[model samples]
Target: MVNSFISGLAGPLKPDLEMMAICKVSIPGLKTGKEQTSEVKRGRDPIFNQEFFFDHVTIEDLDTKNVSITAFHHGGAKLGKDLLIGEAVVPLREIRELNAKKEVKVIEEIKQAIPK
Candidate 1:
């Protein structure tokens, strides 16, 4: 099984911006898994005490899968589109090791997506 938890965001986020967090599990040879939090409006610090789960993950999949958590601004200066604020990627193998220690609070710095 795979699990994702989004706690909150803190930084220079615009106060009037509406935002949400998305959690996606990418497993090789499988469908992309996705889950999202509800919109938090008008706040620099958005709290999303949300958890997502994928039920069919096998032990072998841990070494080859990754979980991506992305934050997005909803309908702001970009007009009708959701703009990517930042994102973090974690390998499932690392998560499994942390889970064994019972300290799975893997903190990662969010990074801007490279222009493509």
Candidate 2:
């Protein structure tokens, strides 16, 4: 996964489709600038997100449990726009770490990280 992120971010994608997925994700720049995609595909439709964005800051840490979905977003053409954050959350069916001492520990860690 790290390799995929590094390679896709560092150089051109070779698999074409993956490259297209990487290309589909963009950041703030000239033309059609897009916020970097912190998307993490899981075993569901809504999908798991790693980055969370607020109006002014970006939450890059992957916190898939409490990730929120913006139903309607405004701003943008007025005074810039809100942070392009991903909603990180831990789905009910998420896989647990084999070496996790306790599942609550990881969840607690994630909860502590999510912004208020």
Task: Itemize residue pairs with steric clashes in candidate 1.
Answer: none
Cα error, candidate 2, residue 17 (Å): 24
| lDDT of model 2 at position 67 | 22
For each candidate in turn, the TM-score is 0.58, 0.18
Off by over 4 Å in 2: 1-79, 83-99, 103-116
Model 1 per-residue lDDT tens digits across residues 1-115: 4455555664665666544433333443545454535556666667655445555554445567777667776755656777676678878787654355332332221112324
Candidate 1 local distance difference test against the native: 0.54
Question: Cα lDDT for residue 44, model 1?
Answer: 61
TM-score of 2: 0.18
Instruction: Give me candidate 1's TM-score against the actual structure.
Output: 0.58
